[model samples]
Target: MPRMLDVSDEVRAEIGDEEAARLLAGESAPGSYDCTSCRTPGDSAQERTSTVLFIGDETAVLAFAHATCLPSQVVQVTEEQLQGAVRAIGGTGAESPQQQYQSPQHPQQQYEAVQQTPQEPQPQAANLVPEQAVLGVTSGLVLLQGELHPALVVEPTAPVARPGSLGSGDDFLPLLIEQGFMPLTELAGVPPVLHGWSVLLAAGQLHAVLQPSPNGGRPVAWWQAHQPLQVTDGWRAAANKHQQVLMFAAPVGSIGRQPREDLLRDALDKAAANGKLVASALPLAGI
Candidate 1:
């Protein structure tokens, strides 16, 4: 029996026509699988399924998603991220797929949980070790040069120490400046878009910001969520309307933990004036 599967042109090109035809004929396609995007059960024999290709540095994995939840497309991911996904699919991760997808009773809740944290715990701080720098993201619309643009303000919760110089009072901005992030004198113009880096937004919510892999094949999530972060309706509307956002990153001491949105903007202004800010504009791509 034939299945209702969407073998996109890109997927076909990558997997070749013969393999795609085999999948359509049910020789290779799984009867039921979890939606790659939303983590819900999907039946290819009953409803249309989108063939999603995840390409890593040296390997490519094919996954399936419901046509309604996610359109078929090729997603470039770091090898590690792809391996994690493979582990989840193979039920080798700490939590089995059933357990991971079992909670989130509501569809909306499930959608929000799509960007679950990796099975490995983040390195923790001990009594002798300082806490890792955690970047806090605040989203708002900033009026720049008489134009309103959606922007994300990132501030480290604590001072970030340079490698081998812990607690040396070194600011984080200079470290980022050594990278490609540009110092913004003013928000008069949008920052340059960094290649292979993008903000992930889908179904009107922010998921994560991704950076390219060191091996240079694909991008991986730099920051992801156990639970999706909430944003204002206005901010979400802005993201959906413009389909992009500006990301500003600064060192911990640069912003000093703003207490309110107005205060946060003030801190950003100060950082710009002090030449301690780096920024980039990113398009909203799906995770």
Candidate 2:
């Protein structure tokens, strides 16, 4: 993993010149500021300073803490790091510390849109049970369809925890969106009506569908997978053609295994030939 380099101006001001220099040099000296809640040692022992590095041209932020701390420590450090920095500098601004990161022009508009949207109603068992029961027993059913004209159709049935009880699977939509698939606009108008069924249409069609378990009694749980196929010359071609692909279709549940390096290399070669880049997700070595 790469250490973060660039920090915000506010962060620099909070730590002052000497402490900031030590952190940038990758030194976590004694007497540095630690997050009060997480209790992880800070970059410098003299002040309570947590390091925040925005990785890869500000694409994402990755914060590091002491090895003994929990993952939640990163979250806690992130929540307060900026604000604490602001307070350290003794600067008073109209906006709260949290608001400093927001792009000024769109903040109000974004807040208003969120307020205007009504909460979606929960899904009922009466509607979801029938679909889940049927799909759970079907074999080789087209859970996801690929190699379509210009888009893919994902037909994942809603996951069912109970025949009629509200389920966590109903709430997986936002996760899918975060993964770069566009939520079907039609489905967004209504809440949980489609259960877990979502259609993501991109330059290629990506489908997330449920797979039935061998056991007959358990309500079907949701799984997401995608297939990339190109449609050209009026013929549907079934070939993998996505850059940043995530596949959960592996026979083994853990997709983070490293023994399949050979297979991954071959796939990367194929993708490169097609003018696409391959990025694989590897599990942390000790983790």
Off by over 4 Å in 1: 1-8, 14-72, 78-131, 165-167, 256-263
Kindly list the per-residue Cα lDDT of model 1 for residues 166-229, writing each as its tens digit.
5667466776666567888765677887666777653234556777766666676767643345
* Model 2, span 2-53: residue lDDT tens: 2233434653443345544554564433233232213223443233333442
List candidate 2 segments past 4 Å from native: 1-7, 24-158, 161-180, 183-287
Clashes of 1: 0
Q: Using lDDT as the measure, which candidate wins? A: 1
Screening candidate 1 with a backbone cut-off below 3 angstroms (N, C-alpha, C), the clashing residue pairs are none
For each candidate, the alpha-carbon lDDT, in order, equals 0.63, 0.25
lDDT of 2: 0.25
Top candidate on TM-score is: 1
What local lDDT does model 2 show for residue 199? 21
